[model samples]
Target: MSLNFDPQWLSRYPAQEPVGGAVSSCVFCGIACGDVEAHVLAETADTLCFLDHLPATYGHVLVVPKQHFQDLLDIPEESFQHVMATAKQVANALRDSCGASGINLVHATGQAAHQTVFHFHVHVVPRYDGDSIVVFPRLADPTRKHEVAQRLRTALNAPQPPKTEAESSQA
Candidate 1:
């Protein structure tokens, strides 16, 4: 399916401009632009899916937007939705083709969260029985659970600030 994106969306993000044929600093952008070689699985109007070079599992794949977006916050809502829809299709293919018992959709946003690549992408990992990958190892503390929930709820209930002129123009 084709993506419905604002024509001026790329103009709003100056850093997304390509150098030569690709965004020089971001490898994912190069792949998307066909400047870099990758074992591509699928491609859509707004997204690309390919095998991970350093896969955690045999059929591990990455689903990314064709345009350059550094992180989750930088991606436009329409582009992000297309990426997710593509990821879901990839997950199903992995399970059917790779004989995976389960699937894990992993997305890391920042350095502290173990995001090595700056580009906005989702890792579609196929999980088999007895796999050694430990996605989440931290234990939750029950004592502060109520306080944490309240804090998150308060933030969710807060009204968003009005967009500036620059932001409105981009939209």
Candidate 2:
């Protein structure tokens, strides 16, 4: 291998899928299971949408596919479209609920992608002038990182899918 680094060289690599491990366990999975308090915005056969437990903004929400895939590559194309379509629905709902100017839909696939939770989820943050939350993320303590990672890993190990057909309808 050449010692020289090149950005273009990295592009040659094919994308990778999420590997299930400890990080798959997250409290968010509990929220997704209705074990915790979350303002559910939408749910489809392939996806479910809810407010972010830790709000990025007043109306921050999340859209997750029903299947427990950690990252994008693990998601089937149909599930991907369903998740994104649900995200769009949540964006509209957030606009109506919060009366915001706009919304931002986001996702992080890998650790490098800032995917704190291993389960695949899309963020829908409502944007408005003078909002309390900032766009930037705060840094975390490195010492506690491993412990926190372990906790999340345990939580997401096994996830229950949406319980009923009614639960899979519009928000």
Candidate 3:
């Protein structure tokens, strides 16, 4: 058993700390802490909006909490609400500035949900008419929609799963 936290020493002993699916050396966390550089757009007490390093469109933005929330599941409701509001602002700025055809606020929660970045962030992707990117292709109606909706509605109406101590305190 040994301890190694040297950033430069990572080349010799590559390792990482995983905290509830969150990487301690997360790039977004560095950016949040001002340890990394980013083209900042807007910042609030709880959230930060910035241009995506790899833009899907011209004004693609990423809205994230200043705190290191691993994903949507880890963020508090108030922080999540603020993040959504910041995303909306970014979307409106994109639309008003460039007359965007549409905008997609994408939040990939878990690894299974295609979340590459462990940090909780909403991608404000702007859409333009005739843009090469196919935001959403037309798809045939799903089978058993009504049946699934009824099942989901019934599930939604059922009592929620018991909360943990942390969640109960959050409430």
- Best candidate according to TM-score: 1
For residues 49-149, what per-residue lDDT tens digits would candidate 2 score against the true structure? 88676676788888887667777876666778888888888788778877978787778778676566677888888999876554434455678988999
lDDT of each: 0.83, 0.71, 0.79
Cα displacement (angstroms), candidate 2, residue 10, comes to: 26
lDDT of 3 by residue, 1-171 (tens): 344333231244222333575555787888887888999988999899888887778898999998888777778899899999999988899999978989988787765555666788999999988887754453436887998899999999999889999889978
Q: Alpha-carbon error at 20 in model 1, in Å?
A: 18
For model 1 the local lDDT of residue 96 reads 87
Clashing pairs in 1: none
Best by lDDT: 1
Order of candidates by TM-score, top first?
Answer: 1, 3, 2
Clashing pairs in 3: none
**What TM-score does candidate 2 get on C-alpha atoms?**
0.60
lDDT of 1 by residue, 11-49 (tens): 343343223334577889889988899999999999999
Worst 10 residues of 2 by lDDT: 1-10
Clashes of each: 0, 8, 0
